[model samples]
Target: MLTNGLVVDLQQKNMKIALIGYGKMGRAIEDIATKVGHQVVLTIDDPDFDAETLKKADVAIEFTTPQSAVSNIKKCADAGIPIVVGTTAWYNDYNDACDYVLSKNSGLFTATNFSIGVNLFWRITEMAAKLINDYDEYDAFIDEVHHTQKLDAPSGTAITTAEKVLANFGRKNNWVHHENGIGSSTNELELSVRSFREENVPGTHTVSFKSDIDTIEITHTAHSRKGFASGALRAAEFMTGKSGIYTMKDLLNE
Candidate 1:
C-alpha cells in the first residue's frame, strides 16, 4: 500500500502496466498511474508490434482505434497479460476477445467511456429511467459531443444511455441518429440521440427527459480527458488479480 506519498514496498506485487497506445489518452494514463503508485513498464505504438516485449507487463491498458484494439488485446492475451481496454467501435469482436481471455485464464475489462462521473451518471440515469417508465409523462432524448478527431458518431456513451433508457421504457426498440430524419409516430417513446464534434472537446453526454409540464436534464461534461485516463488506470489495477470479462458497471457496482 502507498502511504505518506511513498510506495513503501516495491517487491510486494508491484504492477507493471503496459500502455498499448501513446496518444493523448495514453500520456494522461501514464501521468495518473504515476500519481497512483503504479509503474509503466512498456509503451507500444508501432503498427507492427512484437508480443515478446509486452510479455514483461503484468497488465495492459489499451486506448487505440477499433481496428487495432482487438489485435492488441490478442497480443496481450498471448503474452499472458491481463488487459483493460477503453477503445470503442470494435465491439463486434468483444465476445471473441472475452472467449480467448477466459480460455487463457487472463483477465479482460472494457468500458465505452471510462470517466468516473460518466459511470456514476449512467447509474443514476438507469434508476431515473426505471422510475419514469410507468409514468408515461416524460419523453427522453440523448445528445453527445466529442472532439473532432473522434471518428464514431453518436459515441458509445450515447449508445449506453439509449440502452439504459430502452430497458425501462417499452417504447424504444432501437435508437437512430437524429440526422437520419426519422420521425416518431408509433407513440412508442422515441429517444433522439445527436452527435457533435468540435475542437478539443473531450466528451459531453446530456440526457433530457421532458414532459408537457416540465423538463429534467442530466448532463455530464468532461473538462478534460484525464478522468477517462484515471479510470482506465483504476481498471488496470482492478484487473491485475482477476480472470474474467468485465465492464465499468462491475467496477462501479463493486
Candidate 2:
C-alpha cells in the first residue's frame, strides 16, 4: 500500500526514521525509505539541528563525516533510539561508542560500506587474497573512484577492502596510499591504494593483483546510490527493537 508518497509495508507496518545527514546519501535514504513503506520523521543537516526531533523516530540512519558521526550517534543513543550508522573513518572511537550504546541500552549498527554488493565484494576479495597468498610473484593494489564532492580520499570502502585483503594475504603487512603511481617497495609486501575523483560518479572500487606474466582484478561499480540507501533502511528495520552494537557482517550473517 502507498500513502502520501510513503511506502507502507503490509506485514511490518511503518517505521519512523530520523535522517542525520542531508547530503547525497541522506537524500538517497529518504527517497528509498519512503518507497519501502517507512516515513522519515526528522532530518538534521544544519549547524543548529534540533536533537529533540530525533525522539520522534523509532530508528535513525546516520551518514555524516567522521568528525561528527560519533557525537551524532551518541545523541541518538542518549535519546533511547536505535540507530544505523553508515559513516566511516570514525572507527578509531568505535569501541567507546559501543560502550556508550550499551550503557544507554540503545541499539547501533554500523558499516564502512553499506551497499550489499560492496559487502559481498569484501568477502570475495578475502577469498581471492587467500588464494594468492602463497604466490609471491603477484603484487596487490587497490584503486577507487568517486565524485569530486566526496570529502575523503581513498574512501571508507577502499580502506575496508584493503583491510580485508591485508588480513588474508600473508605477504602484505601494511597498506600505503599512493597517487599517480604505485609505491616504491617492489620486494617488500605492501598494498598500494589510489583514489580518483570525477564528476557525478557514485562509486567504483577495484582490487588488482599484478605480476610480470598476468593480472587479476575484481571491481564493484555502483551505478546509483539506491543500493546503499536500501541497505541502511534494511539495517534500521533489523535494529528496530534490538540492543547492543552490531556490524554489517553480523547483519548479513543473520
Candidate 3:
C-alpha cells in the first residue's frame, strides 16, 4: 500500500505465502503482509501438517520451534517453495537446510533477530569492536533479556554480539554463559553474556565496554514485535526471485 509519488511502479507479483506457525509472530506477519498486498494462502499448525496445502503457496514463512524448523524447511524445499525462517535454537542444522535448498534450486533466508533496528545495532557493534581492538583499554560484555516464554538462553542477539566482539577483538575467542553472579577475573578479558526472562518483555540487548577511566554502552530494545513483523514482510518482498542463503543484512543492502 505504498502511495508516495516517488515510489517505484513495480508490478505486483501474485505471491501466495504459507505461514508455518500460527503463533504471535505468524499473526503479526499476516497483518503486515495483508497491508502490503500479499496473500496468505495457507496456515499449518498441526503435527499432521499437510504439505499439499503448503505446495500451493509461492513462499513459506516459518517461525516454529527448534524441533520442527528443519523438517518444515525440508518439506517446503521438496515442494519447490522458497522459505524465510525466524526460528532459533536449531541452527546446528542450518547449513544442512541451506544445502538442501541449494540442491533443490530454491531460496532460503534465515535470521536470528529480524528487526531492522536489531540488524543496524549488529553493524554498530561490529564497528565498535573494531575500534576497541587496537586499544587494550576496554573490556566488553553483552546482556540480553526476552520474554519468559522464550525457549533459548542467551538470546540469539547476545550470541551475535559476542561473536562480533570476538571476531573484531582478539582478546576473547569464546563465550561462556555467566549464570548466577560470578564474573571473569580482571586479567582475562571476558565477554559475559546473561539472559533474563520476564513476562511480556519483547527483547532487549546491551553491549558494554568498560575501562578504568570511562565506560561505553550500546543498547537496542524492542517496544513491540511490530518492527520484526514489518521487517519480515519487507524480506518477503525482497526474496521473490532470488535463490540462496540470505540474512537481514542482505535485505538492508538491497
Candidate 4:
C-alpha cells in the first residue's frame, strides 16, 4: 500500500480493514485504504458492534479516546483479530493489553503519532537531546498545539517527545505539564511541556533546548490529518498476518 507517499508491502494477498472509530482519522483511513485496493468491511463508532462484525476484517484500526481504547482493543483481541491503536492517554494499561494480545496470539500495533514526518522528527529530537546531555547548561522543554476538540493536554505526541528527551538527556528525570506556568527552580529538575489549543490546527510539536548564549529547536507542524491516517493504513497492512505486540518503531525499522 502507499503510505504518506511511500510504498509498503503487505504480507497478505489483500486486506480487509475494520475501523473502530469513524471520526476524521477513521474517514481519512477509509479513503486511503480504498485507494490502495483494501476493503473496509466495518466502521464502528458506537457500542453496538459485536465480535462477529469485528472478525470480518483482517485487521482493526482503533482511534478512540482513552476511556474507550482498551475496551475496543480487548474486543478485537477476543475476536481473534489483529488491531492497530492510535489512541493516546491509555498507557497505564499498555502492558495488560500486550498480555491479552499475547494470550490470543493476536497482533497489536500502536503509535503515539503515526505521521512519517513526526517519527523522523523523533529521531532528530533524540539526536539533539544526546548533544545537550554533555552541556548541562542547555535545558530542554516541549511545546505542543492541537485543535480545541482534542481531549488531552500536552498531547500524546508531546509526551512521547518529552520521554525521548529524558531518555537521551541524563540530567532530566521527569516531565511536568506546566499548564499555564513556566519557571526554572534552583534545586528541582524542572522540564516543562506547555500545550495550546486552537481552532482547526492538525497538530504541532516543538522540542527546544536553551542555554545562556543560544537556543536550539526542532519542530514538526502537521498540515493535515491525512499523514496520520495514511500511516495507520500502512500499519494495518503490516499487521495482517503478524502476532504479538509491535510498535511504529518496529514497523519503521522493518
| Model 4 lDDT tens row, 1-254 | 55455444434356899999999888988887886688999999996678888878889999988889888888998999999999999999999999988998888999999988899999999998998789978888898888989988878999999999989998888888865335544434767888888899999999989898998989999988878987888788788878889999788993
Clash number for model 1? Answer: 0
lDDT of 4: 0.86
What's model 1's TM-score? 0.88
Error of model 4, residue 118, in angstroms: 1.0
Regions more than 4 Å wrong, model 2:
1-12, 179-187
Question: What ranking emerges by TM-score with the best candidate at the front?
Answer: 4, 2, 3, 1
Error of 2 at 119 (Å): 1.3
Q: Which stretches of candidate 3 lie over 4 Å from their true place?
A: 1-14, 179-189
Write one digit per residue (lDDT tens) for candidate 3, span 1-254: 22321122223565788989888899988876776578999988865786667778878888888889999988888888888888888888988999999998888988888887788898899999899878888888888888888888877778888888889978876787764225654546566787778799889999888899998999999887777776676667677766788988787783
Q: By lDDT, is 1 or 2 better?
A: 2
* Whole-model lDDT, model 3: 0.80
lDDT of 1 by residue, 1-254 (tens): 43432323233245789999899889888876776577899988775989888878889999888899888888888888889998888988988988888888888999998877788888889888788777777788888888888877778888888898888766667777753223443444456888877788899999888899998888999888777887787778778868888888787774
Candidate 1 stretches with Cα past 4 Å from truth are 1-13, 179-189
Q: Which lDDT values do the candidates have, in the order given? A: 0.81, 0.84, 0.80, 0.86
Q: Which is superior by TM-score, 2 or 4?
A: 4
Candidate 2 achieves a global lDDT of: 0.84
Enumerate clash totals for all models, in the order shown. Answer: 0, 2, 0, 0
